[model samples]
Structure formats: C-alpha cells, structure tokens
Target chain A: MSRVSTLLARETALAWGKGGGPMVAVGFYAGVATLLPLAVGSEPERLAAIAPGAAWVALALAALLSLDRLFERDYEDGSLDLLTLSPVPLEIICAIKCLAQWLATGLPLALAAPVAAIALGASPQLSGLVVACALLGGLAFSFMGGIGAALSLGARRGGLLTAVIVLPLFVPPVIFGGGALASLEAGLPWSAGFALLGAYAAAAVALGPLAMAAACRNALS
Target chain B: MIPEVSIQSLALSRGGRQLFSRLILKLSPGEAIALIGRNGAGKTSLLRAIAGLINPDEGEIAFGGVEPAEAREAIHLLGHLDGLKSSRTARDELAFWTGFGGGAPAAVEAAAARLELIPLLDLEVRRLSAGQRRRLALARLLAAPRPLWLLDEPLSPLDAEWRGRFGEIMGEHLATGGMILAAVHDPLPLATRTVEVGR
Candidate 1:
C-alpha cells in the first residue's frame, strides 16, 4: 500500500479504536443536544427556534473534545520525533492527521447531526441542509482545531488552552453555518452563508497545515 | 558502501544553560561510539541533534553522500522512549514503523525473529515487559537497517541474556558496515570509541 494509505488506515484504526473514538464525540454532541431541551423545558417552539444553532454549537464542542490528543500523544511517545524525520514533510503530516481527525470524528458527527436536529424539533425538511452544513462546518472545525492542537503540544493545560485558541477561530464557521440554516428556515436564499462557509473551510484546508507544521516543529525543537 | 557522519564544532544548550559546546566527532562505517556522561550532560541532546530532531546551537553535522534534507532517513534513532502505542500489538507496531521507513513486510519478520520477538508478536504492547519492549524497539534497527544508529540507554531493562543478545546484534550490525552512537553511563565492550560529555 502507499504510505499515505497506510497512514490513513492507521489513523482510522486509532480513531475508531475502543478508546471511545467517534463514539465519545458523537455521544457528547448528543448529550449536549438532549440536555439543552430539558434544561430550557420542552417548549417545542423555543426548541425549534434554537435547535439549529444549538446543534452547531454542540458539534463544535464535540470536535474540541478530541482535538487535544491529536498530536500530543504522538509527541509524548516520541513518535513525533520519528515522524518529523520521516521522508514526508511536516506539513503533509499535519494535513494527514487533520484528515484522519475529520474522517473519524467530523464525519460521524455530521452523519448524526440530523438526528439531533430532528430530536430538538428542527424542521425535518431542513434535515438535508443540516447534514450538509454539518459536513462543511465539521471540516472547518477539524482543520482549525488542528492549529490549536499543534500549538498546545507541550503546554500545560493543553486541552483547555486549545479550546481557548480555537473557539475564536470557530466563530466564522459557526456564524456561516448557523446563518445558512437560519436563512433556509426563513424561506430566504441561503447560498451566501453556504458559500462563505465553503470558502472558510477551503481556506482552512489550505492553510491550517502550515500553522500546524510550524507549531509541531517549534514544540519538537 | 557506508556513510560517514562528521560533526564540526557542534554545540547545544537547554533552558539557557549551555550543555556542551565546540564538540567534534566523526564516525565511519563499522564503528560504534559510546557517549558517556552524567544525567544532565546532554547525551540525548547530542543524539537528537544528530538525528535532526533538534537544531544545534552551533556547528554542522554532515552525512556524506546524502543531501542535508534527506540525511535523517539514513539515521535510526532509538530514544529512551520506545515510541510504541500501548494499544497496538507488537506485530502491528513493527509493521507500521518498518513500512513507514520504506522497508518490506519481510523485514518485519526478519527483525522479529532476530530479536526473538516471534512469541510476543500478537500481544499488545501494553502487555509486554520493559525488556520485551526494548527488544521490540531495537527490532526497528534490523527492519529498516539505517546506516547510523543513535541509541539512548539501549541496555536498560534488559536482563543479562538479552543484553548479550543485543550486543551480538550490534556486533553484527557493525560487521555489515553500520555505525552506532549510544548514550550510556556504563560501558559497552562493543563500542569502538567513547565520547564523554559535561566535563
């Protein structure tokens, strides 16, 4: 097999392993979605109004839960040293890691978002849009989160630090994604928000690895 | 053909403290260098610098016949950390690393057999003893066969028998024109040269 395919396979195994890989993130997302309704009382009107935004927020937080361990475990075990020395450049390594993270956590979360949205009384008609938004929004979250994970490599309180660094960067995606959904619900053209979200995700895919690779090199050094 | 590593006036520092400076060493094929030093003497730092894991504060290390960018592939560094994922079986770990290093599947089998790791191949790394883990880590050397080996405290956790086995492996490697630079407090009879730091 090709080196990249091998790497992707290994990452998929790690992310799908018994260690609560995608399950934990998706569970967290569902938990957050389920609790919001109970905490605010089962007012369908209110829940329907807030469901899309709440689901987006929940997905963002769920992605955050797994981002800290993205590179930190490899760094701790000295695998990062060997990886840095590999024939692949550090940027490509970062990209591969983020890609794996997206495949494992983001993809599952995206697939599950519609269920959560419908449970929270979101328009079932918007379910398709919810899935589409989740996929794009999740991609943005994973790549942006990669920057945070890489920067916090050797820092104390790394998980908390990563959330702080990444949450701000997530604002644009959240707004664009949520705006797209809210506009769709209002019977308006939502293409503008969807286009903006796609652009944001594309930019993250292109540039997140550069920041991650630099952070990784800094942490190693 | 064998590779030679030349270090000219290499220097390293950690946390604003200069660990070593103006050090020079060279190793041709079929030679082993034992780096002897105290705990804070930067033995691992030197090895890491040579492995391209860290930048030297000063000086250059050149691997003859290899581009500077590609030199790291020629150096096999086994640090104090075994670098194995506890969740992975010994077989999977070896296969992943060897394949990553561009070695074939046959190399993994040969390495496992050489290290007497056949019995433990299917076991998770978490189930292995320290000595077993060390041997598994050492197996990477055979699997990839890099010319320069940087081993940090390679003998730790090994019993007398395994230590003898490891020595034999090192001897065989040198006989085939491979080089080693190992950091240790105690001496190894197999080393062709010794460099002490933190004087």
Candidate 2:
C-alpha cells in the first residue's frame, strides 16, 4: 500500500509539473473568487451568502477540468497497460490515483478556500466549514470523474466527452455542498448536510473503483 | 523454476470484433516466439490479453500456471506505446519503473548505459527522438527482473544498429532462460518460433 501510494504521489507530482492545466485550474478558481467580489460590488452580506456556493462550484470545476488527463495521458503513452499488469489490484490502483488527484488538485483547493472565502466576505467559521465540505465533496467528485476519464480514454474529443459524462453526476455533491454551507451560515443544524456529503464520499469510495476498472476494461477493449 | 507462461484456449473480442478464437499457446523457460500479422490483425491485442491488460470476453490466460493477477510479479510487458511516460526524465522514468519492479538501482543504471541512454538520462522522454524513446523502452527490459516478457512491435522505430543490439539482448534473455513473446513485423536475428495471430 505504501509503495502504491508513493508511486501515485510521484506520478501526480510529475503530472502537476508537466501540464499547465492544473496550474490553470488553481488559477482559475482563485481568479473566479477574486472576480466575484468585483462583480458583486462591496456588499458583505451578498458576498457571504454567495461565497460558499461559489467556492464549492470552483472546486467542482477544478476537479472536472483536470480529470481528463488522469488516465488519458498514461493510456496514450502505454503506461496504463503496465499499471494494469502490475501485481496490485486495479481497485487499489484506482484508490491511490484518486487519492493523488485529490491531493494535487482537490486538497490545494480545499486549503486555499479560507483565503478565497475571506475575499468573498465569509466568516472564519463558515469558511472552515466550507473548506471541510469542499474537501469531502471534491474527493467524491474526483472519484466519480475517474470513471468518466477511463471510459473516454482514446475516444475522439475525449476531453469534451469526459465533461459531458461527468458533469451531470456532479449535481448531487454541488447541491448537497451548497445546501450544507447555507445551513451553516443560517446557524441551523448543519450535520445533515455534512452527513450527506460524507455518505456521498463513502459511496464513491466503495463503488468508484469498480466503475473505473470496468470503464478501463471497456476502453481497452 | 516455474515455466514462464501457459495459455489454453484463449478467446478474446473487442467491440464484438473477434480478435482471436480459442487460441492456445505456451511459452516455457528459454523459449522465444514471434507474433506475426498484418496491421489490425490482433497482434497487439493478443499481447495485451497475455499481459492481462485486457480481459478476454471468453477463455483464460495464465502466467506461470497462475492467473495474471496471481503471477503478475514475474511478468513484464512492453506494449505498443513502449510504456514510457514522456513527461518524465529518462532517469526518473527508469528509477520509477525499476522501483515498481523491485529492481536494484545499480542494475538499472548499467542497463541504461548499455542502451546508450546514459547521456540522455536526465532528459524528459518527450524531448527524446522516437528512436531514442524506443531505446529507453528497451532499456526497461534490461532493468527489470521478470521471467516472462511480452513485447508488442518491439522493433518499431529502431535503426539497424539498435535493431541488431536488441536482437542480441533478446538472445541473451533466452540464454538466461527467460521467456519472450514479441510481436514484430520484421524477422529478428534469433532462433524463434512464429505464431500467426490473424487468420
């Protein structure tokens, strides 16, 4: 497990360095957060109300934007086949890859949220909750996105196809995530929202790998 | 030692296209076989099936008399794209793969030198020419310690000198009692049996 994790980390780090897409993704998130304040004027109440949703939305988009490269590059380069042939189970590989994706893209976005939230006039408490939700929700998004990424491997216009297949599935997390933040901001019991987000992440963790492995088999077929 | 690979009545399909129908082949220690076929003839597909990268719609494949998942540690496959990650330096790529294969660092370095990739070790694979990339891919064969080798179009993009050198490597592998099944368009300079993949 440690070996696989190490490999996954190395691969993800290499990927983050090689492609401008991840940087662009982080930049785009920060850019969108920065721009929201300018567009909506200096109204703190309005900014706080929209901040949580905006942050979650940005993270979701970032996760989606970077997903197509997950398996596509390796598939094109034939390294994916080597991965499949490795002694490890495909499920373990999928888990590690998803972990790596979350670490590289999702985790950074989560860590950056408090600053982005501050820009959007969110209270520190609300910002922290938003970050937690985004971390859980973003992991779920990447887990599900991996299935789409593997499915679209080697297809014509694969990037667009991946987005099309994956974006609709993002709706649940986005809704639950935004609703969770809304409840938090309203001082209502927000555990339900957190529970839902946790459930979604758990479900993704349980089933995402199988779906990814099946998609990989189909793509290779 | 266990025989490197054994296959019995392997059937595979892609998108309802029958790639192979009830194919049976076995590769034992010190054996070398060439998979010959025209383009789209399922040569690469067969190699992929053997490597366990693609599951057959029907039938089974085994390495060392065990399922691919069970015997994966003993098998090494070089598929159509050479399995080289272009974004990484040659040294980093080799280091990662050798580590994955649990190979020694010294052995991998020596293999890189033999493949004449020592100078380009720090160069990213994407910056290397096609032949250079092929050489790097071949170097992987030397780095890892595995009993069974499955190569798809191993000779693609190699110049004559490298081609001869690759043949020598293959010969040396056979002499060391390693088993190889390589798909090639041209004949290799070695005593090799032939398997016509597409009929």
Listed per prediction, chain B TM-scores read 0.96, 0.93
Candidate 1: regions farther than 4 A off: none
- Candidate 1 DockQ vs. native: 0.76
Worst 10 residues of 1 chain B by lDDT: B64-73
Model 2 chain A lowest lDDT segment of ten: A14-23
- Predicted candidate 2: what Cα RMSD to the true structure? 2.4
Q: Candidates' lDDT values, in order?
A: 0.90, 0.81
TM-score each candidate: 0.98, 0.92
TM-score of chain A of each: 0.98, 0.92
Scanning candidate 2 chain B in windows of ten residues, the lowest lDDT window is: B60-69
Across A24-70, the per-residue lDDT of candidate 2 in tens digits comes to: 67888898888878888878888888888888787788788888888
Best candidate according to TM-score: 1
* Candidate 1: residue B198 Cα off by (Å): 2.1
